[model samples]
Target: MTERHNAFFTDIAEATRLTQAGRLGEATALIQRSLGGANLSAEGARPTDASPAPHGTPRLEGPATRLDPEVDAAQATLIPERLRENIDHVMQGLRSLVPSLNGLTGGGQQAPGPNGTEPDGVASEGGQFVERSFSNAAGARDYKLFIPSPRSGPRPLLVMLHGCSQSPEDFAAGTRMNTLAEEEGVYVAYPRQTSRANAQKCWNWFEPGDQGREMGEAGIVAGLVRAICAEHSIDRSRIYIAGLSAGGAAAANIARAYPDLFAGLGVHSGLAAGCARDLSSALSAMRVGAPGAAEPGGAAGFGAGAVTQKLRVPTIVFHGEGDGTVHPRNADAVLAQAGIEALTPRQEGGINGRHSYTRTRYADDAGRIQVEAWSVQGAGHAWCGGSSAGSYTDPNGPDASRAMLDFFLSHSLTGGQG
Candidate 1:
């Protein structure tokens, strides 16, 4: 192996030791330094020098989608067998320490059909699941809209974004949000990420162009929301957004870029807004959590001077203590960016205490919950309390869908202090 690969292995070993010794912060910093700053992509590619965009705008070249094989091959191939085993061992231990990184990346198992649908016994009998598409200046994208039957007046809308490699149907089945929406008399929308946008069908939450108001994916999604509101009798004040993993990260970006558009937000296994600008930093943020901040240049379409803001939307976060793909520490970083100084005493219980979790509520001085965090013990990257019919789900965990709905119902744009 070359000198750089040798150093990476050394850092990996040392990080493992530190993690075992319970010095996670030091290990994270060490790994960060060994990786050589933040311009690195997830696929181990370095960014080329490109002219910076106007202040508060994306780079002129946009985001890079693939890694350079010639540059990254050595790093990829030189990983010694022993070192690979050691890394796996370290990850297993870290999962125990973290508790939330339990499952492997992506949803756990695959279901059949285009939408990954199987008959769901728990799903409401008469709900409508309609496929729809919305377009704007940016582009057109497809989405699945679910409306519970027998709704009389305007209903709350919840936009659900799926993680990488997951479709709206898979997400709906996993989270069982549609069933819960039926019971709660809420409307649900699942916006799908296309392969043309991302090969893995993941939202480009890490891309600078996609992070701004009315710019890329965020803008497209916002347009979809407005169209939905116009067509359906949506309660604008009660509209909210939530997602898992990449979708969760995108939800954070959306809430940051368009705070007025959403009253509350839920992020599961997700990072905070502006936590990463490229794939490399995104991987780092997922592995070791980064401090959340807005990009330096203002987003193009929000207004002349409207920069991405620190999160002010009322929010709730759920992460596995052992989440290996996206570190559990990210939940804390999300709360910190929300300007939460302290949290209430944690309460513990889930599924009659069979699947234990710790919950803490962050409230404003007015005693309104601005943020809530749940750390599921022994849970992994999958959705806690999710169904097996869909991908990346942990049925034994508490019902995140139910909890999010309860939280969303309690807050609104005009009255709630998010």
Candidate 2:
């Protein structure tokens, strides 16, 4: 009963069946073959040198599937009218959103998947993933905490924020940051963004209400971090925050808001804090660098002399040169916003094989490294040196987890700032 007309639908159904049956590797290949995508991992990465993004959830970009006019009309109700648009228009909008909608659709991930991944950080690799929550005057947020093996003294804390549409589990699997925590005796916390806040589960870094030091999302996140520090005996001087995409953008803003709280910062494919004030400007910033920023989200967005007056913190940045979702110029904008432009950087080229990159490092008057940036060659809006088990990861080269953690630990909060 194999009908020639039903081949495509049949293949799709079989792929779904395989995915549900936990044959992720095979299901991914079939979906790619059926959809005419390149040989790619479940995370839209190549298993080898071809892969080069991290923590950025895979997008649903593909050749438009044309249907009969009657079929199109019949399926119009499948999507809400307000959300309906031509493929090009929808793709353009999605690009600006810097979305990670893969989990919502349930296409590929598996339970008890590779690297011992599980929902809510359960079934992890030799560490405990505990669920926790924090509420403040601003709002409430739930988070997952990764506790390393028993240690004698205080441990360093790393606050990790996930990209749009990604959860703590997905981000952990992608970046393998928790693995680093286990190996290095560090505590990791993942703050969740509720859908009630943003439809995409994106951090509201661009919103004026959320950017304040003691208001909105920034306050709530900082409160949570402080609570964790007290509860887990975290080293205040060693605390750091990092995020991918919107989370990265949020990290930048949070660091500025609470300069004395975090000692180091990491932004991966993210925009600078204060890059935009609302959705419109956020979209523009994500597309092209913020031209009106006065100094890449500094003087204009915050105020005159706001950044220069603040204490400096050590920071490390990672961005793919080919990131289409978030303009690569945003990276330069981030450095400028951090005031690294005032210091001359010693540039190094071609570190690590396959997905070669150029690294820039800057030091201060004391000869201490203050800032580092990685410009990944031919990479895109994803986490670098991540595992393929999670969404938005590219298993290429130049491990971001190692590089970021090393950078964070090397600098401690001395006199309330790095």
What is the TM-score of each predicted model, taking all chains together? 0.69, 0.69
- Cα lDDT for residue 109, candidate 1: 19
142-202 per-residue lDDT for model 1 (tens digits): 6778867877889999999998777887788889898889988888888877654675677
The sequence of per-residue lDDT tens digits that candidate 2 reaches over residues 1-418 is 4575367555555555444333333444554455444443334321211122333543212112211111113333433333343422533443333224323323223234445335432334566666565777777676778888888889999999998777777788788887788889999998877554665567887776677688788888899998897788788888899999989988988887887899999999988767777677787778876542322233364332233333256789999998898899888777876678566689998756469899998877666788899999988888998877566666885899999999898888874224
How many backbone clashes are present in model 2?
5
- Score residue 405 of candidate 2 by CA lDDT: 96
Model 2: CA > 4 A from native: 1-125, 292-311, 351-353, 415-418
Clash count (model 1, backbone only): 18
The segments of candidate 1 whose C-alpha lies over 4 angstroms from its true place after superposition are 1-123, 296-308, 342-354
lDDT of 1: 0.72
Lowest-lDDT window of 10 residues in candidate 2?
62-71
Best by lDDT: 1
